[model samples]
Target: MALTYLRHQLHLHRHKIIGFFLLALLSSGQQTLAQGKLKGENLPGYEHKRLRWGFSLGVNASWYQLEHSELYVEAIKSNPDFSVNEKTGIGFNVNFISSYRLSPDFVLRAQPGVGYHSRAIEYKGMPADDDNGIAGGDVTQEMNTFAGELPLLVKYESKRRKNSQMYFIAGVKPSLVVGGQKKGSEYLQVKSLDFAVEYGVGLDMFYPFFKFAPEIRYSRGISNIHKPSPGMFNNSIQQLNTNTITLYLNFE
Candidate 1:
């Protein structure tokens, strides 16, 4: 009788342990199911919402123009005998961007960008004429500048189901002149700093799975960037107008 009682007690204990383990397994499964449902609720409905970080590299065909100033003509005519060539050139830029969704249709973006620029002038004409040339004699001038820029823009996505979007951007970019020089012997110094009010329109085409976005932008600078040479008797004016078009690849 005692042996039978002991065997019965052992069997009861084993059954209890097995029951506890089964209960724990069921509870764990329930928890996992509940967590999965919560995760599904937090998933984004729009395709673009999945894009939050990206990088962009592109080229900018830039036009650098001097503002209209009476002093400009005066300076060219100081010697009154040389011709001046003013022309815009091409440039390149790279960018890193971070995007944050403000709404289903709107996003805020911050982009830090860098670029290289070049412009040139060739002087020609009669050296003896006072009404047509410069005091520096016949000369050619070429300037190459490197600039760093940062832009913060609010972007509006198109409501269409296509992968294309249109955006209007307004921002401020301050650029520093890192390198430049005149071709001839005339001593010239470019201004070290330029501030611009930037406004532009851009279009972006997103690839499948949000892997990359290729975009094109057109922007205009609203400030002048010229500093007159010192000790001049006239009110020397400065010109600082820039027009830039950029093509970028945004990777998210």
Candidate 2:
């Protein structure tokens, strides 16, 4: 059920998401073309540096990848229309970046950051006498959290063209829930630790003083973050994984 729902959601929005990324990529290319042609190579030696530091600010949209439990059938029998859904939410992140140059085309990067997020789990068709007893028909519970994220990544870059370059990044990110309700009687509990795979593409625009990059990244949770708790909403779900899409503005 989780996989099916995820596929359906992706199918519905894949075109819009793809187009948005392509448009952004095209706009960046155009801007680079307009300026790079008139400017001599800027920061010619910047890429050769053994180590560099920078930071990133980003905005994100986050949701959950949900899976039904074995008790889902029991839930359905109790409430014929019972279903669980997730709502996407907006979030933001700030990262202090440190990178090491491995070769002309490859770099190793570590981004340690804090992220703030608020997402929700929605339950529909709950019986009136449901567990946690709040005259339940449809219940939406919000999960707000602050996470400390550490991402170790490998960046592969294209050959520099004048003052612009394109790159792809892939890595692993491990996160700890620094602030949030870990467990409760009224809300679905979530585990404090999570691990995810990260991948993204970006354009690096070189200026006289700094390198500016616009990046679009996606993170897919590999660990099930669900923690059992005392609620029908929690009991109906067996797995909860995270999904996040972020657009980052980077400076180095």
Worst 10 residues of 2 by lDDT: 1-10
TM-score of 1: 0.63
Residue 108, model 2: Cα distance from true site in angstroms: 0.4
Report clash pairs, candidate 2: none
Best-matching candidate per TM-score:
2
- Residue 156 of model 1 has an lDDT of 72
Q: Compared with the true structure, what per-residue lDDT tens digits does model 2 show for residues 1-252? A: 343254346653534644665677678779988999798999997878999999999877678889988887777886679888887666789999999999888999999999976677888886654557657788887777899999999999998889988999999999999996645556788998999999999999999999999898999999999988776767889999999888888899
Give the per-residue lDDT digits (tens) of candidate 1, residues 112-165: 878776544444552432332336445545456777777777777665334444
- Candidate 1 residue 8 Cα shift, in angstroms, is 99
The backbone clash count of each candidate, in order, is 10, 0
CA shift of 55, model 2, Å: 0.4
